[model samples]
Target chain A: MATALNKPDRTLDQRGLLCPLPVINTNKAIQELKPGQILEVLATDPGSKPDFDAWSKSRGHKILSVSQEQGPPKVFRFFIQRSG
Target chain B: MVLATEQLQEAAKQGFKKKLVIVVSKGTIDMLYPAFVLATTAPAMGIEVDLYFTFWGLRVLTKKGVKSAKIGAVGNPGIPMPNLMGVLPGMTAMTTKMMKKRIEKYWPSVPDMIKMIKESGGRIHACSPTMGFMGVDEKDLIPEVDDIVGASTFLGWASDPEAITLFI
Candidate 1:
């Protein structure tokens, strides 16, 4: 199984959950990150795109990029920075 | 000089240790989850938490239509609606009702989340504007509200030099 990201301190693999799960779990992931550091989230939900955007806005984090990969799992990779 | 570096690191860590509090200004059902979940979990991670409910957001703190809170495309970004469904007049209402069922199925009740948040030591606030606009007395509000305050009260919480504030 591909775990998606190999990061220094923060990586969340949320593949099987639906709707709010990806957003909720990502919220938890961001609170642990350092101010300048980034959190990488790998999700399978297409809904993850807007959900993460709303979450990032309300949680005061930055969504640096959301990359869609071509594969069976339909990976949605999010690079988020903890905002001030 | 190694001791100096260690001391500097400690100070930097301390400076970044301020607690964050957030306010939820909207109460559409889909919007409520992000606020309640984040506020409840904040204290679990050792950060102080506060949630101020105002307007429709107050519905979560009141009994009139708490379970009916839902999202639509007028401005809600969270709904996964297709374009055809969005243009219909009753679409938001229909979508909201459908979402209500899903929320009831998938998550805890709003009242329960409020209880959990309080039990977990997070603070809840109701906006005075909403109360005034809706003609709601404190008794009309769910008992979990720590106080009835303006959004400015939460802004004050968020405004500290070291603190972070978010709107959900």
Candidate 2:
């Protein structure tokens, strides 16, 4: 439950991208990480949270955690673990 | 009686099938977008994708068409632009340019979406009969086209029992 303990192998900054870009980029980024490695994605797209949730379910990937960073520009962060 | 885990696994494996086929028949900016969006997303979920472009849909693969793809503003009331302005010369062109710029703010450009689809492993097919009807040659098509095939060939790809076909 506490994914904060696990350091991400890589981080993807997807701010300013919108609708489907975040999902598309996140999918590609996960490919570079080894299976079981963590990928932290920071996206400003409002759709990113639901999109990642659906993607993780369909791909069998694990979503370790999802958190929000309220900013002058708000950001949605997802911690995902690549599935084999 | 509870079945063995191995038996359950075998049954689950037998039920698994993951293939998607989309047939696009219109080339307008609005019409082409659903196909583009879906094609790019499906492959990311490990589903194999085949997109068949036919008739006017083939225009989406052309340089001029893709560069100037426009919304049909006259008859349709969906666009907020005044119907009187729709008939004016250059109005459609002006509206399309403005719309395209606005779209870029929220979505990837059409060319980038096509590139993403290819890089994600989705197949793009242009209808061969349409090419002949329009007098367009292979050289006229963009580099992303995987093949030019007739209806029969596309039917063959869509006929697989495991494939889910959608007409867009």
DockQ of each: 0.05, 0.41
- What digit string (tens of lDDT, one per residue) describes model 1 on residues A1-84? 123223424778888666555775676667777786778888987777876765565445777778999778788988888776
Chain A TM-score of prediction number 2: 0.88
Q: After superposing candidate 2, which stretches have Cα over 4 Å from the reference?
A: A1-6, A69-74, B1-17
Q: What local distance difference test score does each model get?
A: 0.70, 0.80
Report the error of model 1 at residue B6, Å: 14
Candidate 1 lDDT over B1-168, as tens digits, reads 344334433544675444557667787766788887677655533456777776777877776655456677565555676666687798888877777677666556777777878886788888888888888877776677789888567778777755557877
Pairs that collide in candidate 1 are B29-B69, B29-B70
Candidate 1 chain B: worst-modelled 10 consecutive residues by lDDT: B1-10
lDDT of 2 at B128: 90
Give stretches of model 1 more than 4 Å off: A1-84, B1-17, B73-90, B101-106
Best-fitting candidate, measured by TM-score?
2
Could you tell me how far off, in angstroms, the CA of residue B29 lies in candidate 2 after the best superposition? Answer: 1.1
